[model samples]
Structure formats: structure tokens, C-alpha cells
Target chain A: MPIPLIQLAGVSKQYGDVRAVDDVTLELEPGEFFALLGPSGCGKTSLMRLVAGFETPDAGRVLIDGRDMQGVPPYRRPVNMMFQSYALFPHMSVERNIAFGLVQQGMAKGYIATRVAEMLRLVKLEGYGARRPEQLSGGQKQRVALARALAPRPKLLLLDEPLAALDRKLREETQFELMQVQRDLGIAFMLVTHDQDEAMAMAQRIALMRSGRIEQIGDARAIYERPASLFAAEFVGEINLFEGEVVQSGEGKFAIVQGGGRIALADDTPLPGPVRIAVRPERMVMSHLRAGSYAEFAGVIADMVWLGDLTVWRVRLSDGRLIRISRSNADAANAAFSRGDQVFVGFEAQSARMLLS
Target chain B: MSLVKKTRGVGDGGLAANLGRRLVLIVPYAWLILFFAIPFLIVVKISISVQRDGRPPYEPVFELADGFIGAWESVQKFSMESYAAIYADRIYGDAYISSVWIAALATLCTLLIGYPLALAMARAPRRWRSLLIVLAVAPFWTSFLIRIYAWIVILKDEGLLNHALISTGLISEPIHIYATQGAVLIGIVYSYLPFMILPLYNALEKQDTALVEAALDLGATPFAAFRQITWPLSMRGVIAGCLLVFIPAVGEYVIPDLLGSDEVLMIGRSLWDEFSTARNWPGAAAVATVLLVLLLVPIVAYQRSHLQTHGAAR
Candidate 1:
């Protein structure tokens, strides 16, 4: 669809004996906001650099709009990168910084002036043309860097942890602003971040990375609801895992927990002895009474935390197993259980997914 | 009311202390005026003093009634003769031109070799950078005369270069490289090469390499990035290196004396001849004055520009 604005095939980059990015193959549709999410040194930034032509892959190829970027340098490539530090030239004024790429491309002086003015307005930094980067606040500097990266109108824009430098509140505000700009321009934006919340908030789809390979790639809700692997589940969001073994294999398979507790599965998949079941905290329902409507286990409330709008309950099952459950403020009074109180935790069989470890 | 009275008394004491501090600051100012400023005035006084024809280069019993008149008449009357004589002589004219040309050429050569070396030093690995920097400046630590003498051995007709070339079959005979202008230029460039390298290395090394990358990311080619960002940003070092090499090269005497033939007569040698052989103090002073005047403008300009740039950056 839309010719897949950027295509990366077998893009592996090595640093000496260490492979920073291993055999990454992915594509982004035009105007899609794609995020490569991982922890630090997990090769997310390395992947972005490869796409921006800053680092050449030791093997494999990076293609932008069906053209192989073999010998092409960063300047010649039709991609622009916004560095994490903003990397604004301190010697130049705000206007000059934004106009740098246009000038380099040999655009007419008048046209550059007009385009730079328009960009400054787009970023809502109008009338700040004469101020240097040091004179601006953190958010202003971020806007200037964004304007500069967008000034050349490249086919693909790479953002390397663009909001990492901003404060929490400012970062949240700028995330929406960045999303708006990407939508307005209709350009493919590839964002690299170790921040899961940031990725979920901005990107249409995410490529979650680990070590040197893509762990999983899917839409935000799919990745969160159904992670294909343990690493993907742990990386994307908080999940309570119960280590167990498959005792029966059929349409309604069952798993025996470590301490003789049983969990029924919805679908039967061929599996060896050891397996793990992952379930979201909110999916597990907690009640003071034994409802007896679904798979249930008796537990004691170990700890409780009130997080303004939601209450968190940590419950230890009868078999010495601990599970976390979150209840919204609207449902806080339903159980009314505090620490050291007895409760029952239950979940639907279809809600929990089994992950092979 | 009591506290106010005490504070007022303290304020009076503070005023007295401030006055004492101001007086203490004037001490260096007075010393500078007496030692530096007054000596320059004395030189002006002596230069304008008239010398009688039969007297021992001094005027005694001169009329104070004609005070300003005598100073003017003496400057006009007692000689532009030295100036005229120096310019009329072909040897002095030739020496002046040769010295300027040689220094300019040496400065150019130093820039050509030192710029790239400095860039390499700047981009070198951090662990290897210190070693490279020390190697670039190690030659300056050795004795200057020994370095010049070493050059003499290397540039001789049957010396290292010629011998190497002849043995390699690149030359049929030992070329006459010694006691020539080319030899002098080699000696000048070699001796002062460190002076060029150190400043340029400092400037290039201090540059933030991110700026270069930023330029390239903005669509500038590698060479364009270097020309637009690296070169202009390192200009302070270039200017410093040029001045360091050019100033001393202009007045160089030893290298020319040891390395060049009799055909190369430099201003330094001319000044030496006027003072030692010709016994012409006024003529040598005149030559010294001219050289000093020629140098003072550029040095002042360089210092002013340097200060202006630093001030602007701040």
C-alpha cells in the first residue's frame, strides 16, 4: 500500500564481533508513524542510523522508495535525521538553522527565506528568527530541530529519541505536536525510542527490538494484548506470568501450575512439558466472595496502593503465588479489600494466553 | 535607631577602604608610565637630537631658544641621508625583498603541510591523540640551532635527500641543493613547522566534530562540510600559526647564514652589517625602525582582531 515509503531488507550492522542490528527486515507505508522500541544499547538507534545512512550495514541492504542505498552518503540519501540532542548549530540563529538544508541544496535566497518563515510559523515559533539556540527553552529547541529536519522535505524522517531530552510534562505535550506535524506533512516518520509509552502514544505500528533482532512487530493493541514471545510481553507492558507445565493437550488444554494449581486454556497447541501463561493485571478479577462463575483461586491481599484514579492490589494465591490486579476508582468499592484481607482472583480462560518459554 | 547608627559608621569605614583599594591599583599604572612610556619618549628625543659635524655624535651647547625649531631642523637637516643611502644601495633593496618573499613562501608551505596534519591529529583516536600531539611538538623541544644544523646536513649536495634519490636511480647526479633559496626555504619551513602545527592542532582539536556532521546531514558533501564548517571555524588557529611562523621568519638570520649562499642577503644580515661592519648606528637604527614599523601594524591588527573575536564569542 502506498509503495511502502521505506523498505529495509536483511539490514544487519556489526561492530567488530558484536552485531548491533541483526537481519532486520521491515517496511513502512507512506505517512505511517513507525517506532523501533527497545532498551538502551538494544540496537534501536543503530537501526535508525542505518536507515539515515549514518552507519552502513556490514551486510544486507537498506532501500528507500525501491532504491538501494549502497554507496550513497547521508547527505545524498533522501532521508533526514533529528539527533537526540537536537544538535542545533549554536553559532546560527533560529532562522538560519532551519534554512541550512535549503541553502545547502542551492535553493534561491528568497525561496529559502519564505520557506524558513513558513516553517517557523508551522512550529509556532514565529518572531523568534533572530534568537540563538541557547536563548530558547528545551521545547523551543526541539521545535527548531524538528523544523530544520523537515525543511528539506525528505521522503523519510528519522527521529532518534526526539523527546528524551524534554521534561515529563513537556515531553507529553511535544509528542502530540510531533504526531500532528507528521500527519500534516504526510511523510513517513521512523521514531527510535526505548520508551514504551512514547511509542504506544505516537506510532501507528511498532517494531519492538531486543539484543540485536526484532522481537515482534505489530499494531499497538495487538502487541500489548497478544505478545508472541516472553521478551515482547515483558518489554511492551506489565504482565503477570505464571510458570507451569502442560498436563493435557486438546481443544480445552490445561496447565498444572508449579504448586499443583491448574489453569484451563482456550485453544490446544502442541507443546512440550514446560510452558508459561501470561495475563494482564486488569484481566484478573478480584472479589471478596467466591463467585464460582469461572476458574477461581483463593488469595490473601498482600499489598494495596491507591494511584489517584485506580487502586492496585497484590494478591498471593493459596499456593504461594503472587498476582497483581488493578481496579479503577469506579470499581474500588466493589471488593473494598485492604492488605491481609482474604479474596478470590479469577479470569476467563480465553483472556490469558500461553507463551512458550 | 541604634542599628542604623552602627551601619552608617560601618559604611564610612567601607568608603575609606574603597579609597585605599583604588590608590593601591594606581601603583602598577605609575610604574608602567615611568618605565615603559618614558623610555619610548627618550628614544624619540634622541632620534630628533642634532649631531654636529666635528663632534662625537652629540650636540653640546645647543640653543634652547630654538627648541622645537632645532628638533625639526635636525630631523630634516641631520638626515634622511641614512634612509636615502639604504634605498639607493641595491644590496639593501635586494635583501628587503628577499626576506619578505622567503618568509611569505615559508608561511605558505607551513600551512600546506600543517593543516592536514592538524586535521589528522584532531580526528585521531583519543588514546593515540596525546602521542601524536607530543610528536608534532617534540621538535620544538630540541635546540633550535641543532635543528637548523640537522637541516643543513640533510640538504647538502651529497646529503641524505640527494643520496637517497641517486641510489634509487631517480637522479643521475647529486643535485646542488645546498646554499640556495630553496635550501633556505626548506630550513625555515622545517624549523618553524612546529609553530604552525601546534596552533592549528589546538584550533582543529577544539572544534566540535558534531558541527561537521550536522553540516553533512544538512546535505553538504564531505568537502563542502569541511570548507564551510571546519576550515572557517579553525581560522583562529591558522592565523595564530601564520603569525608565529611569519614574524620570526621575517627576521631570520641563522638559517640563511648557515644554509644559503652569498647570493641571499636578508634584512637581518643587512642590519647586522650596518651595526658591526659598517659602524653605521643611525643607518642600522633606521633599518630597525623600518622593520619595526612594518611589523607593528600587523601585530596590532592580529591582536585586535583576536580580542574582538573572543569578545564577540563571549
Candidate 2:
């Protein structure tokens, strides 16, 4: 709606025989925080580099603000990247580092000074103008890198795992700070991270990548609740998978599993042959007594892990199929199901969706 | 506390015993004091000693009773006379000036050539980097005199360059370039080029190329990235290369002697003439002292500046 601040259309990059980024086509709306989430070596960083003009697309085109980026070097592009290592100039002070881009752009000295001061204040590092990068803590260095990348006021800002170097607590704190900055500036931010929780916490939209291709792209909740592929469902969060065959596909769809018998599902799509049903672990209900439901199975608790907030129980059904169920600690405590205890696992028919692939 | 006492007693009985410890350290310490410090003191004493008429400025003559006068008269009577004599000789003066200018020019030439080579060295492929480095430094393993002499074969009147040019019909006659200022400069630059390159290669090699890309990303052109980021970051290498070239270039006598004509005088030749031909020990010492002073000032300045910049960065 806002003219899509950054557009990567069929962009692909190849290193020798290996395709690092394969036919990636995506858009980033203005003022939106977008994330590219994947494990290491999945081309998320390569995608960010392509957008930043660090690496030229081997085949397709990268467009920023509707202008083609062919033959345009990084400095001329209206995009800035914050490297994962922070890449702060070790020789320069905080103020100088922030002012580097402005100085290179030939802004007047006084204006550069004023803008740098304002940016330092924006990142809440106003008084640390004279300190070098090594003198600052990890969080402060991250802020300096952010301030430096933002000082130029590029149309799109690229962050490559900005919080990967920070400790756990610091990373959490800085994630909120980064989100606040992105929102306050109202600029499009493309963040690359392998951490699912980090992506969910920060990005408005996420592109989950695997083996150089986008497995799925959607809002945080959609990607978590309804992944388009088995890879995306498993990668985003834990899910209990039930392998079965589509025995009947009409108004009431049913899947007959190998070990377990037939179970009625909500999906009515014409999926033929074999398919798998995916359900969130938390969506499952576990009890010692067999409750009347659309689908039910008796199983024994093989393992029980008591986290303070939640409890995870591994259930082995009578057909020798394993299913994981997560319940709140209060509920699990009241039930008091330990290992070797028999339990009944049941879920609503509408909750489990049949994945054709 | 008891354990500390026991260890101390053992240390005192073992390697820290007075005689054994003294025996262990005395050889090297005494060697250094005798060979290094005492020799330096002897040179200082001889530099200030007064000269009699017949001897070689080392006659044992004490005139101190006449007003604490031996060293004082040496100062007043000898009184920079050798300095005056050497200064009066226009050849020595011109040679000193030429030496400084030639050394400075050669250092500049070396930097201009070596920087790009070092850059190429730093950017070479991983497998080729070691080969390039070895090639850059391989000239050092060959004899220095041999290398200078090799230039003789290349730059002589009927040498390889002129012969090739003539055979190619580029020139009708051979050109005499060997005994000229150009020849000396070529020789000096060639001899010291590796010195310039090694330091620069070391410094440039240590640079994380990501910094250059960071500069380019921040809106610097390729050349601008090199100037603002690469060059300043490699200042340590530049200083080291300049020192490596300048110090030896100023005192170099072999290349000039072998490559240039007698008309081209340098401080090294002047010092050689004073000692060998002119047989003026005091005058040669005076010239050597002048050369020493000339060389010491920049070395001190360079060290100070290097320390200051390094300290600031730290």
C-alpha cells in the first residue's frame, strides 16, 4: 500500500554450482519490519547482501524505491546494512563512526555535526561521542551500528543478525529497542536472523527460508499457526505430526494412519493417497480418562518434563505412535501424570489439518 | 605462608643460589657490557679526544694543568676545525644534499611501486598469496651486492636495455644511462623496493577487507575507500617502509659507486674519500658525525610519532 519501499523480484545468486539465493521475490512495505528467518547457510544473509548491493544478483533484479539496482554499487544505493559483527570502525570514535556516511556525502561540517549529535541522542548514546568502539559494551556497540546505519536515512535498512552478538538478556532488551527505533523512524527494516523467537518478537512479516528458497512468507501468527509446508511448520515451532493416508475425501474427510486406525479430520480438500496431519502440541488435550471427542486415542506417558510455566508430556499411543502434548503447569500439576502412567490424548477434528505433502 | 617459605627456601637452594645464578647471567651481561656499552663509550671518548700534529689524532697529550685544558682546548682548539674544513669543501656539501634528496626520492619511488604490489599481494588468492609473498621477499636472499651488480649488466652503455631497444630499431645508437642520476635512483629504488614492500604487505595484509567494503557501503567510491580507509589504516606500514628505505639509502655507497660516474658525489662517497683518499680522519669523523646527526633526527621523530599515534589508538 505504501509503494513497497524495497522489492526483490526473482532475485537469485549463485556461488559456482551452488545457488545461494534461488529465485527470491519479495516486497517490503514502508515502515514495516520484515525478517528473513532461516538456519545458517540458508541464503538469508545472501539475500540481505543482494538488497544492500554487496553482491550482485546472478540472474534477476533488485529494485529499491522502484529503481533498478543493476551496475549500481553499494555506496550509490539508497540502502544501508548493519553487519552481524557490528563492523564498527575500530579506529574511529562513536561520533565519527556515526558521521562517516554524512561526511562522505559532502554535507557541510556543521550540519554533519548537528546530525551526528542528533543521531547519537536518538540511540541514547549522546555523551559517548569520544569513546571508541572497543570501549563500549555489546549493547552500546549495537546501538552505535544502528545509529551509523540510520544516520544516512536510507530508504531501506538491512540488519544482518543485529542481536546475535549480544548476551541473552541484552539481546532481548535490544530487540525491543530495535523495534522501537524501526517504528519511530518509520522506515522499512529487513532483518536476517535464524532465531525464531527473535523473528517473531520483532518482525511484522517473516520470510522463512530453507536451502536457498522461501519455504513460507506470512505474518508471525500465520507462519506459526498455519505453515504452508512441513519444513516451515517444523522450523517455526514444534508440532506433532501424524502420518496417514486419505481414506475418504468428501463432506467428512478421514485419514487412516498406518499404526492407528481411521480418524476424522476437518480438511475436505481432494487430497488423494498418502498425507500427514499436523497439529500443534499445545492444541492437544491429555487426560487419564478417555473423553468423548471427534478423535481420541489411548497412550502411556513415556516422558514428562515439568517446566515452571508449562509441562511437556511425550505420549506413546496403543499403536506405538509417539505424540507430544504440552499443557500449562497448573493443569499438568493437578493431573499429576508421571512416566509410565496411562493417558488419553484427544484433539478437536478442526484443529488438525491434513498436509498433503 | 608455610608453603611460600618452603618454596622460597627451595628456590634459594636450587637455581637461585648466588654463585650459580651469577654464573648463569654473568656471561651474557658481561659480554654485552664489554662489547656494546664499553665500545660505545670508547667511540664517544675518541670522538672528543684532541689530536696532536704527527699522530693520527690519538696522541697521548695532557694539557689539563694549564686550565683544565686538554678536553676544553680540544673543544676550542680543535674547535670544529674539521667541521669547518669539511663544510668548506663544496664537494662534501653537495654530496650531503644529494644524498638526502636521493634517499628521499628513492623512498618515494619505492612507496609508489611497492604499495600497489603490496595491495596485489594482499588481494591474491589464498593459494597464491604465499607464492607472491615469497616472490616479493626472494630478492633479499640473494646477495645485496650481487643484486646491485646485476643492475650494472642491465643499465650499462651497451647493456641489455639499450641492446634490446637498438635491435628493435627503436634507437639508432646505444644510450649511456648507467653513469647518471637516473641510474643511481634506479639502483637505490630497486635495492630497497623489497624493504618497502614487506612492511607494506604486512600492514596491508593484516587489514580486514570488510572495512573497505564498509567504507564503500557508507558512500565512498572505490578509490575514495582506498584513500580514506586503506591508506590511513596502513600508515604504520608506510612509516616502516619509509624508514627501511631512508636509513640505508642515505648511507648507501655501493649502489652509487657501481652505478654512477665520479661526477655524481654523495655523502657516502665523501666519507669514503675523506678516509681513503684524502686521509683526513678528523674530517671523515666530522662528516660521519654530520651524517649521524642528520639520520638520528628523523629516526627519533618517526619513533615519537609512531608511539604517539599508536598510543592514541590504544
Best by lDDT: 2
lDDT for model 2 comes to 0.85
lDDT of 1 by residue, B1-314 (tens): 99999999999999999999999999999998999677654433433343344433434322456688775665565546567776798887788788989998999999999999999998998899999988987987889899888887888987999989999999998998899999999999998898999899999888777677777888999998887778988888999999999888988889898898788878988888776676565566667667766777778999999898666565
- Cα lDDT tens digits for candidate 2, B211-285: 887788889899988888899889889999999999899988988899988887778988888677866666666
Global fold similarity of model 2 (TM-score): 0.89
RMSD of each predicted structure: 5.3, 4.3
Report the lDDT tens digits of candidate 1 across residue range A254-328. Answer: 776555356676555557478777888889878788887555778899998888788888999877878888878
Which residue pairs in model 2 clash with each other?
A: none
**Cα-based lDDT at residue B143, candidate 2:** 96
| DockQ of structure 1 | 0.46
Interface RMSD of structure candidate 1 (Å)? 1.6
Per-residue lDDT tens digits of candidate 2, residues A1-357? 456778888999999888999999988888889999999999999999888888999888888888889999999998888888887888789999999999899999999999999999989998999999988998999999999999989888889899999999999888899998898999889999999999999999999999899989999999998888888888888898888787665657677755545677655555668877788999987778877754677889999887888888899988777889998876635367889998888676667766766
- Displacement of the residue B11 alpha carbon in candidate 2, Å: 12
**TM-score on alpha carbons, each prediction:** 0.84, 0.89
Each prediction's whole-model lDDT (CA): 0.84, 0.85
